[model samples]
Target: MKKSLLALTVISTLLPLAACQTASNQVATAQTAEIDDKSEALKLNELTQQYFEASLARNPLMATFVGVHQYDDKFNPPLSAEFIQETRAFEQAYLDKVNQLDASELTGQDWLSYEIFKYDRQHALAGMDFNQEYMPLSQMGGAHTYFAMLGSGQSAQPFNSTQDYREFMQRARGFAEFMDSTIIFMQKGVESGVVLPRPIAEKVLPQLSSHVVEDITQSVFYAPLTKLDSLENLTSEEKSTLQQDYVAVIRDVIIPAYDRVYQYMKNDYLAGTRSTVGLSALPDGNEWYEHKIQTHTTLPLTAEEIHAFGQREVKRILEQMTKVKDQVGFQGDLQEFFVHLRTSDEFYFDSEEEVIEAYTKVKQKIDTRLPALFSVFPKADYEVRAVEPFRAASAAGASYQAPAPDGSRPGIFYINTHNLKAQPKFLLETLSIHEAAPGHHFQIAIQQEVEGLPQFRKFNNYTVFAEGWALYAESLGKEMGMFEDPYQWYGRLVDEQLRAMRLVVDTGLHAMGWSRQQAIVFMLNNSSMSETDVVAEVERYISIPGQALAYKIGERHIRELREYAEDQLGDKFDIRAFHQQVLVDGGIPMPLLTEKIQRWVASQR
Candidate 1:
């Protein structure tokens, strides 16, 4: 699944030089022609503005996620024939207009802007045939997590206002139709063998049923109203009216809507769900799997090639892991040491608060060393928070939610505490580096804060580039004077091995026909991760094809780029400036990213 698009016959790949146009002539022409570059920049900005407005008009839930409130009460229409047709037309128009622009005429930030903008537009169009909606609402992609976000009273949805309450009621009405459509899609999955695994289906039933309660006041969605009284501007009378309306919406609409979907899954869907391992089992599985690879990597590597690479990486990381064994003075072979890390108390936190604190300490430690590695830093402040109780069971060991670009909220690094054993103290430094400080927070915040780049470039993501950079940041621990503690250093290697394992286990499960249990066994045998972690990671691979491959593959590319730059530039190379160049322009595809770095290296020379 993590393989390149060229590996499958679904889409054609373009040469890098052909896909990109030169900017020098365009820059000079813009300097003296009918308009200045700033005016040309506005065209891209206007397109972004139009795009966002169109998206909000179509999908209100997406609006809420981005801190846009006007659409808080609406859900986007179901993925249907009409939706697909309209989206295709929109993308085609944008691509046609973008191609007309002379990108070679632009330079500096403008050139970076042109490249990223064109890439995303083309990439979005590339996966048109995949039909993501065909197999949506799994344990991973369900709206269940999103509903919890709104109910938490801490996100963008306003619970204190009457208008907000009224719009939410409207949303409840909209959701009923969405659930119906989701069931239709799931039913289609049943027919196509694209259904969720039996284990995951059983795991998700409870979560869906939790929202099916008859009383709105008792629902998780009602927690916002319980906190409404604390808002200073809300008078008791206004609060009462809002609360009453919210309850009606939930009782009369939302609960029943949730109930309908829950009943369908419990009674009808579960019995028919698939027990298969990969996307290859689905209709046109080859094409869909290929699309996922291209979408994630933004490159043209084949599945067989990726599978072979994963085999090599896993072997490589395991060898590095032996050094961890020696450093810690463990008295056994690697497997036995992995067992000790699993069973031993020295590697784990006594409480969830301790997990949070470990990450906090890592942030402080990494902050002092960041200057040594690079000059660029994100302006937005970030905080570490525990993953909310309900979702933590299935959440990643740690994940990041980027702050709203408008500065309405701070970036949050959510550390999962559901299974304490999985959140070992040994992994804190690497986890913190990858998820917070120099990892996602730095990359995402710096991208958002970058000026003179097209708006799309600011938010668009490439898995190889984004996740790879985060994984590579973990290697900075030694440079930052960390990993000095042999056990902690082992944590770094273990984390690296986990990514490497993804390459092996993911391809093994999807491409090589390994069962879910087989994939878990492969990870358990290779790494020091907990059994719970092994199961979760294996399931995650199943739920999201090709996503697992991005972490290590991307990290490897960034490392290679750094090594190449150091070798090429020699005395002229500046690590801080290299970092600045990487972060200042936001995320790019690995190939294009390398080109930009080479340009910067040349500029320094």
Candidate 2:
């Protein structure tokens, strides 16, 4: 979620001493004030570095993902009471120190960095007020899911040497302890009346139970041992020893840990899960959902405003769908056309490889035309792959994982082929554009490679800018000459409709007290989505409120900014330069992004 960086929570309010004295005294006082400003700026920079370091130390998984190896063998610090209090104190102390500085004295990127740091700290503190730690794991993401990926030898954790094998064994120990701690947190959730919806809890059971295999060789935890032969540094004897140790950990520590969580979810947690779908049903849930909306959208919009906006967008896109239906010479209403698109065998693929191949071709077509629109491209390349089977059934249609800062890993676009019928052929071009080329891969990889920015700016994400930019990227399919067929053009409209629908369904479920079935029915009536896809998406909103709102909200802002720039500059407006200006600052809150872009527009005049 993004938060406002322009709202400086702390500014010095004290007035300077009297200037009516002798001119010499006044001049001396002025010099002292100037020195104080520089000294404060220096202190703020030092504090930013310190806060980043503390953040990495507290989150070892984040450290490993960013290419920092020092914490590779450790799990994240336990979410115990003591750790929470200490973290609160740490943020408060930094907030106090940063608030004393005068922003008027800072200039250029230094000032920008200060705003980001302050926004980050204050946002972190605000989130601490929520009891999110109590409901730790979810169907969406948590230690239960991510740990399996990390241990699989196919994720960020490397498995190249004897030392690497040993480090994982230590990590496996930490995993066991972490699992126990998470169960304790879930128990706390029960007492506090904070619980997952029954549907979400049911989804989590299969995810945990998937890892409880009878054979050690089949366990994802034992994946590294299977690949030991590929590591040239490990001798045959060392490989044999590591294999024995790996099996022992999976058999004794890892498998049992999963079984424990599975049993708990099935026996105790399921019965107590919430019956109502909306966050507003829970204690303080309305306030929490409001905060989520602000965080994800980085705006002060109310639920009612977002819901109404979504309704208007959905109606407009449906009208566009009608034009496409008539152009294709279909013989029925919009709903019938949707059913034809959903159920027709001609629109579906037979195999997962065929789906991957279709996206590969789309990439080829889009790459040749990118130079016409973007002057700045990422040096880090990207690859398309299937979402690993373990989580595919529950995963979104398509998602991207950013490249590593050190270039050890390229960015990945995970296309979910779990249900072929759910992935229509016509949708490939827009999905490819949004997830692979100019969407996440381009925005994220460029941010990673940006020079001279703080590490946070380079790697952190603002959901509105990131998801919004991706949604906006889908519109470029028409400009790039790929959506030539009317049906393919309809695919782009379908994509827009999904985002617009999110505004309605997410707010409807979480804010307006709409039931899960009601939201699903609303989506099915408006779009050509499969029942499977609609169900999955609605459940996602149920689990994570207000997150889906970022897409349309963000796209609307970026499109508005472009229109403003074009109107102001007229024939002088360069699309390439406008895009570069948006991406050069990396992911930031929309308010800050708006200010920076307005400045650019004024300068161009």
Candidate 3:
């Protein structure tokens, strides 16, 4: 953006030209040019707003997630063919328009915004090449799974109002239709030979049937009805009427929809599904996985390349773990150490309450220590709580949900205490830091609150940046003056190995044609994860190809950037400022993040 100076000094030859114009006229001309620049910038802003509105319309659930409630009642047609066609056209149109903007005239955030907007459209358009609709619902996550959470009234969907209840009822109908469409899509997959793996389909069977309760009140969908009495504005008659409608919808529409998918999954789809777990089992499967790698990591890394990186990372992390084990004076080799860590009651809790209490303490301890490493903190404080029972089995041991942008809801750091042993006490420090403060909560809540960025920039995620930062956050425990316990340091290594192994196992399952059991065994051999949790994690990779690679790959790049900063800046390096610069812009692409850091380091020098 640097401009060459064109001297406008007076000279003997220019005397006549200078005499032609008055000072007032020159000022007026300059003022008009400045006005024109402002107008052009405003024009660009208007286009981004238009793009934001269309994006919200296309993904209503996303709107609710970020506290935009206008689309709370809606659902995108659950990956129907027509919806896909519309999405393609929508992205193409915006991409064309964005490409038409004059890049030379834009600078600062406006220029950055234009570049990211164009990149997003291009990335999304490229994704349209894959037939992801064929495999709609997975035990890992899908509309049906998220809708269950919303219906439970414990998620982003607000249930305090009569309108909120009615909107959910409306969503129940949309969900049923969505399930019907999902079946049709799967049927298309069956015809096209792009079906889910048999084992993943099996895992989903119980998830579907679990929703079909004999008593309406017992249903997860009935949670709102239970809260109707809390709506003090509602008359007794209105509350009773609302309760009836809620139950009726759950019984007639919702439960039947669950059963329909269940029946299809159990009877029709399971038989139709392929026994092979990898995407390579289907047509153009390898390319589909490559696209997923690009999508999740925002890098053009192939499966093999990622797998190689993962293998090296696994070796490096294992060496670090060995040092920890030796420090602890363990007599066994690394694998034996893993077994001892996994089996020993000395490191586990028998009760869910005890596990929750332990995690809460981790949160409390980390909160006080955060300022040592982080200068910025989230305004919306997060809570440490146990994961809800319904999704707990499939969920990771710990996960984070960002706070509502409008401050209506706090960020939730969910600890899945379903298997108490799986929630090992030693892993508490690293896990809490990853899922709560100075990690997901800090990156996401701060991103949501950052002003002057486009709405998409504020809310959109390039997950490599998000999960990568969280994983990187876990590595910060030592700098924060934590990990005094060798076991806690081992826990850090365990989590890092998990991310590293993801690069191996995700590619192994999808690209190298490794079976589900092979991936599970590889994870079990390398890490101390319980068999039950290992299976769930392996299935998660199978269900969502290439996503798991994000954490490790992203963390690696960010750490490299940080190390580069430290090496270059040396005594001048401010750890707090380096973090601020990395996160000042929300989760951006890896290359862009690299460029931003390189530029910052130069500025500091």
TM-scores, each model vs. reference: 0.90, 0.93, 0.92
lDDT of 1 at 184: 88
**True-vs-predicted CA distance for residue 341, candidate 3, Å:** 1.2
Segments in model 2 whose C-alpha atoms lie over 4 Å from true places: 1-42
| Candidate 3, 1-605: lDDT as tens digits | 00000000001001111111123233433433343334456756766776676566556666677678887787544545556665666666667767767888887677667777888889877776877778877776666677787788888889989999888888778778878988898999999998999888888887888898998878888877777778877799898898888889999999999999899888898889898999888899888888889877998788889999999999999999999999999998988998899899999998888887888888888888888877877788888778788877666677777778888888887888888878888888998888777888899889888888788788777778888898899999998878999999989999899999999999999999899889999999888899998888888888878779889889989999999999999999999999999887887899888878888899999
By summed lDDT, the worst window of 10 consecutive residues in model 1 runs over 9-18
Of 1 and 2, which scores higher on lDDT? 2
Q: What is the C-alpha lDDT of each candidate?
A: 0.72, 0.79, 0.79
Best-performing candidate as measured by TM-score:
2
Cα lDDT of model 1 by residue, 1-605, tens digit:
21111001011111110111123223323433333355556665565555545544555665565557887777655545565666665666656666777776767766766677677678778777665665556565455556566656666566666677777778767767777787888887788677777777876777678777755567777777776666677777877877787778778777787788889889999899878868777777777778788777877877788888888878988888888788768899989988888998877888988888878888888888888998888888788888776666666777777777788788888888888898888887888888777988899888888876665566556777778888889988888898887778878888888888888877777777789888988899999888888888888888778888888888878888889899988988888887887788888888788888888777777
Per model, how many backbone clashes are there?
Answer: 6, 0, 0
| Candidate 2 overall lDDT versus native | 0.79
Task: List model 2 lDDT by residue over 184-214, tens digit each.
Answer: 8888899999889999999999999999999
